[model samples]
Target: MTPDLIILADTVHTLDDRPHHEPIQAVAVSGGVVAAVGSRSDAQSWRQAGTRVVDLGTATLTPGLVDCHIHPVFGLDLTVGVDLSGAGTLEEVRALLRTEAANDGEWLRGWGLNPNAFGTTPMHRHALDDVSGGKPALVRLFDGHSALANSRALDRAGVHGPEEFDQASEVVCDGDGTPTGLLLEAAAMELVQRHMPQESFAERKARLAGLLRDFARSGLTGGHIMDHSEESTALLQALEADGELPLRLRTAPWCMPGSGEAQWKDMARSIGTGGRRWSIEAIKLFVDGTVDNGTAWLYEPDTLGQSTAAFWPRPEDYTAAVRYFASRGIPTATHAIGDAGVHHVLNALESLAETVPADVLRRTVHRIEHIESVPDQLVERFKDAGVVASMQPTHCTHYSLADHSDNWSTRLGPERADRAWRCRDLRDAGVTLGIGSDWPIAPYEPLPIIADSQLRRRSGHPEQQPIAPAQALTALQALEGYTSHAAKAAGLWDVSGSITVGKRADFTAFEMDPLTTAPDEFAASSVLGTFVDGEIQFMLERLG
Candidate 1:
């Protein structure tokens, strides 16, 4: 018997569950599965005619990196528009917008706008109109929870006055109850977005294929995409049919309150565990909005004691939806950012577990997206409830400050701010952590996220203090969060997480061993290559 592909690396981390394991020299792959992992000499013995061998000198290989929560399609759309992610001041943002507005497109769109960059200066419709040149425009804040729309965009969407919503969404209003063009939450943003021209199916599919390739280049073998839509589903289906999908995609369709049991039952019946490359097996729900936009459902109000509403106007309806899905052995991921929001999700899952059988519960794991803030009692309940904390380490590195000086800290105050991202506490409590980049909200690369998890410091701003240094995880633990732990969260652990024999031949190669490299050194590291099912998805080209 001969292997189809053989990968030789200086160090191969299997990340197996065994107590002690030796570093392997080579990995043998056959028929898209890991056939053998042992000494370099042993790998040579299995080689025969037609077996492809690649030697990566001084490189370290590990399980393919998995970003448990991401929005590949949505992120790509925003990225292709004006990118305000690098703007450090309002002038910079305005300059970028001016250039974008001059383009031929009917609507001017941009993403990654952080309000803090403007200092105390207010952000209103007129500010965007000044640079937008009267063209309709919408710029999303870095959080994706809010967006700024120009006056023309507001007129186009016919959002002239305050409107009522069933969720915690808000359209900023002036003293006269006139729309101010600041859209809070998805529901509110959709008002103006509904007026934007829809992309053709062909365009959507083409962009998705391109984005998946980019994801492979960034060292992401797969991800648990947060939301699913008809267009997104069509794009994935087309890619899978053409064999163009380069990464594993697990999507969770949005499940809102008042969607009804019939709709859920039908959705549960239609969606399955998916094929080898992509699938939809989970439902995504939002218990509250983002903390930055003053929409998060908090036990106590924010610094100004404002935005104390839940995403679902009827909290009981959300609880019922969770029970309905959990009882059917389908996983549910709730975006809960504040203490009250986290508590509500936990209570629902805990109550449903009372009647749901152990085997049924074990079949699918319930997950909480962004356990931003939680009390000690709720933290202890995560393990018992069998919940997977699908968290983004970059959220901390990019948003919070250790000295409780950042906007996030100021909003929560010192007491709650100190407890931000208790990753170490949750892990010590025996909880399985699924870490991700939450792309579009932050950077999409996994290496930087893994490093930030260890250093607990912002990626580029070393001058800023680290946020909750004690909450940092060890390098090895951080790796598990992206590999083994992330795979389990997506219910693909048995087939893809570790480099165990019989698993898929998915691997990510890096210049240095992440487990031993200094956190700061991660910035200089480069991705050597990425493989999926024994096939090279991406490889660096030497410039020499």
Candidate 2:
């Protein structure tokens, strides 16, 4: 069959394990799959008259990059206001809030509120009240597990005092039982969130389409969407109706605490359901929340005595849920951040061998996300249980400090803080470590993420000290986290990980060779182009 498209580059890191003497310089695509991969001469001979050829002079090509975890649909809501990710102090946060409050909106909203900005000050509505202009305001913390609502917003939501929740959520009240306007976890946040104005379906669909295109522009050819909903499904369908998606998406709908076997069955049926470029393939569960927010499930309590509880009211129920899905041959990715959470998830997955057939168990792939801090004992267990570690390196580099001054480090204390993001340890233990952006929690640029994995600090901020420097990954290993390892995390290694023949014709072309360039330089480099299913999704004007 004649090739439909051909891409030529000075360097192509196929990342294919099989040894080959000749360097790979060209790849030919036919019907959305790789047809040939060899030297440039070999590619020229295979190309037919109608084949479209792209010669990215001096660019480096690799298997399409995939963010192992992201929340695009959830982000549409989470990222709805002023971006406070850069605010460094309480005054800075207040200043930003004041500016947004001055706008004409009925409700003042913001997101990516870094906890460290509060410093010694407690997270209370009082902090935002003075800047809120008497209007209801809600600002989501950077963790995505908590939010700070002003008194007006709390009052609007009718949350006057403490509230009971099935999961480990909190409405955070003071000594007199007066709500502090701090909401923790999803249920607690929803109290005020439900009162906020909603975006129209068309507006949401347009925002999502723009977001996906931005993702592809950053060299992402695919993403493992950690959260999915009916609205997200419909939005993707609507976007596809206009044309093909900029990137391939593998979605995992959430299964929250109160859900039962009936819901589990319904989610199981959703697997393999999607359009040409998007599909529901896994289940997203949470054993615990974020460490910075004091909702993480730690074996020992933090200094504040918080984070000792699981997200599930009954821990055993989580095990049952996992067993239910594993028995049906569906994979699960649990948000387990602390030692206790990671340990519990591993235990649940390990127990499957006893209940499930050995063959079926062997095929099941369970993943633990945001392994923020875990002891050495839990490191090897990922490989032992045949589980993958889907982590976000930027969560460490951008959020924590080496001096143990940041909220995440201060809460965990010295011993646990020392174990922050054990990326190298897990990889050395023969565990498949897939890295991602976890966007809305952190930035989604793959280059910066790859660089941070090596630097153990923000890619461009060399002045910042490295957090857990020993945990840093090599450049090649870091790149694999978004390529080979990412595909393995989703159980799609056979067809999508590497730039090998017969794999999907997806590619990310970089202006420079990622492996050879310095970390800082690489982070600032441009993505020459990105191709999905052999179709160009984005290309720099210079290249075009």
- Best candidate, lDDT: 2
lDDT of each: 0.86, 0.93
Local lDDT at 262 for model 2: 91
TM-score of each: 0.96, 0.99
Off by over 4 Å in 1: 19-22, 273-276
Every candidate's CA RMSD: 1.9, 0.8
Candidate 2 residue-wise lDDT at 118: 91
Residues 355-422, candidate 1: write the lDDT tens digits.
78878988888999998878899899999888899899889888777777666777788988888898
Clashing pairs in 1: none
* Runs in model 2 lying further than 4 Å from the true structure: none
Candidate 2 lDDT over residue span 404-496, tens digit each: 999999999999999999999999999999999999899999999999999999999989989889999999999999999999998888999
